[model samples]
Target: MEIKIKNLTKIYKNIKVLDNVSLEIHNGVFGLLGENGAGKTTLMEIISTLLPFDDGEIEVAGLNVKKEPLKVCEILGYLPQKFDFFPKVTLEESFDYLCKLKGMNNSESRKQEINLRLQEVGLLSEQKKYIQELSGGMKQRFGIAQALIGNPKIILIDEPTVGLDPHERISFRNLITRISRDKIILLSTHIVQDIASTCKNLMVLQKGKVNYFGSTIDLINKVRGKVWLYNILDDEIPHVDLFVSLQDKGSSIEIRYIADNPLQGSISTEPTLEDAYIYINRKELTV
Candidate 1:
């Protein structure tokens, strides 16, 4: 399956929420990354047929998005940033409802399909439990489960790990990767590491424009030899104009930062995906 967008544009309140964006997404995990208000969600909505674009064209499986929306929906699945099932409803019942919505009304077949989706998401054992009883990670996985009921060729997940703990976050990323074969999974998130760990190809949006779009390795290479590390006292830390993240030791703080010219006594370090993201997001500032 493929999604092709050509010079797509969208406006809200006279502001271009998405400005002349173009991308080609294929069968794999493609990432949409940006900070708040950078148009990630808006673009996702447009592709998912929830919102219409003002200009350009979008084609999913050779069907024009604006003209054949119903056909487009038939092959697309989406897990929005926030969603909820019936609080008192059992997980199995929730799947049954969603499957029926997709026109799979046969009870026996739906039951089998529901079990397969739950097992794919590692929630098979929890299907009899009420929706409200699952943990945050389990809920997000359930969201993916419901999305997959119709065997969609494309899946869109927006910020699926926002409130998850570190372990759950990693687990969720792994789940996305596991089920990504032969399908287009568009993972949108403001969190840098989520993109780093899950996506092989990514587009970084800044202020409604494509700041960087290419392979994740290429993006990481943008800031090679530009990352540095040093130690500073927690109470005596200096204000840095760069995107600096700090790790704490017993008595001092170990800081890793990206800069064109690192401070004296700083050790040059290999850049990670996060270092590159911070650099690109703040590129105009450093230059």
Candidate 2:
């Protein structure tokens, strides 16, 4: 599915959560990187048609989100930053209830579908466990299972890996990557490594505005030659603004820095996506 947002704006009282944002998202895993209060959730809500925007036009899969919300919802699956489930309900029961809410009526077929989704998310073994009994990671997986019930073409996941441990996070990211082959999966997160390893394209938001958006390679290429590596004594570390620090086998310290001129013990260094993001944001902040 194709998602297009144009001149989108949202406000709560006098605070603007989204400031005339515009973006076009196509099939693949597109990462949304931003800090808290950067409007990531607000943008997701507006795109999912869960919240009305103060101004803007959003079209998903060729259907207008505001005017044709029902159609939009039919092909959309959204796992918000904070999801709630019935306290006393079991995982299986919760899926059943969500299916009903989505207008599914065939009990047997729904159960089979839910079971498949649970298995896909590695939660099938915990299907009979009560929602309250599940751990944070389990509950997040359950939320993902519920979001996949309708075979959505456009999936929006907000902070999907927030509470997951390193192992679970990798598993979840892999699952999302596999599922994104034919769908447009919008994953909003603050983890640069997540985007670096999983997403091919990304959008970086700063203060409710898009600071950068494009292919990951293009973004990383921006800082390609600006990064420098310096082999410095531990005592000299404080003199450089280290972008990355590593310990050498010989007790020397290797540091990546941003400098206009070559330092006393510096060499050219390759920049990573994180370096590009830091450079862009730092430049923006200074202006």
Candidate 3:
């Protein structure tokens, strides 16, 4: 499957939310990386046929979204950042309802599909649990299960792991990794670690524009030799430029920052994906 977005633009009132954005995605897991209000969700909404764009074209699975929305919807599944299921219903009932909404009329077929989706997301044993009884991570997994209802060729997941413990985040990532091998999955989030670990290719967005688009390793390599670690008194921390990360160490603070020239007593350090992300975004902030 392939999604082609060309010169896409979206305007809210007079402001440009997505300004001439364009991207091409094939069958694999691709990430849309950006902070809040950076137009990542706007682009995803346009591609999913949920919001209309001011200019440009979006084609999903060879179908033009504006001209054939239903056709595109047939092949698309979206899990938004915030979703609420029926609080009073069981997991199976909720899945069944979503299947019905998706136009699945055959009861036996819906039954099989619901169970299959639950199994795929590792919630088959908990299918009978009430929606209100599940934890945040389980609810998110159930959200994913609902998105897979129609077996869409393209799936869009927005901020799936924003508020979870580390263990739950890893589990959710693993679940997405397993099912994304054969489909075109677009994982959208601001967390650098999410894109670094889950996606092979990603596009970084800044103020509704593309800041960087490439393989994860290529992005990381951009600031490889430019990052350094320095120890400084807590009062001196305010004077450093390009501070990417900071850790408090009692009387002093350890700071990892990006700079063209290293400070005195500072040692060069390896670059992480977060460091690379900070480098790019910080440049934009200064500009």
- Global lDDT scores for all candidate models: 0.89, 0.84, 0.89
What's the lDDT of the predicted structure labeled candidate 1?
A: 0.89
Please give the ranking of all candidate structures by TM-score, highest first, separated by commas.
Answer: 3, 1, 2
Clash totals for all models, in order?
0, 0, 0
Instruction: Write the residue-wise lDDT of candidate 2 on 206-254 in tens digits.
Output: 8888899899999999888777887866645545543554557487767
Give TM per candidate: 0.92, 0.91, 0.95
**Candidate 3 backbone collisions, by pair:** none
Instruction: Please estimate how well model 2 matches the true structure, expressed as its whole-model Cα lDDT.
Output: 0.84
lDDT tens digits by residue: candidate 1, 1-287 = 68999999999999999999999988899999998899999998998899978999999988899999999999989999966778999998888888999999899999899999999999999989998898888999999988898899999999999999999999999999998999999999999899988999999999999999999999999989888888887566654557558788888888787777777898988888888888888843321
Worst 10 residues of 2 by lDDT: 278-287
**Which one wins on TM-score?**
3
Pairs of residues at least 3 apart in sequence or in different chains that clash in candidate 1: none
Candidate 1 wrong stretches, greater than 4 Å: 233-241, 283-287
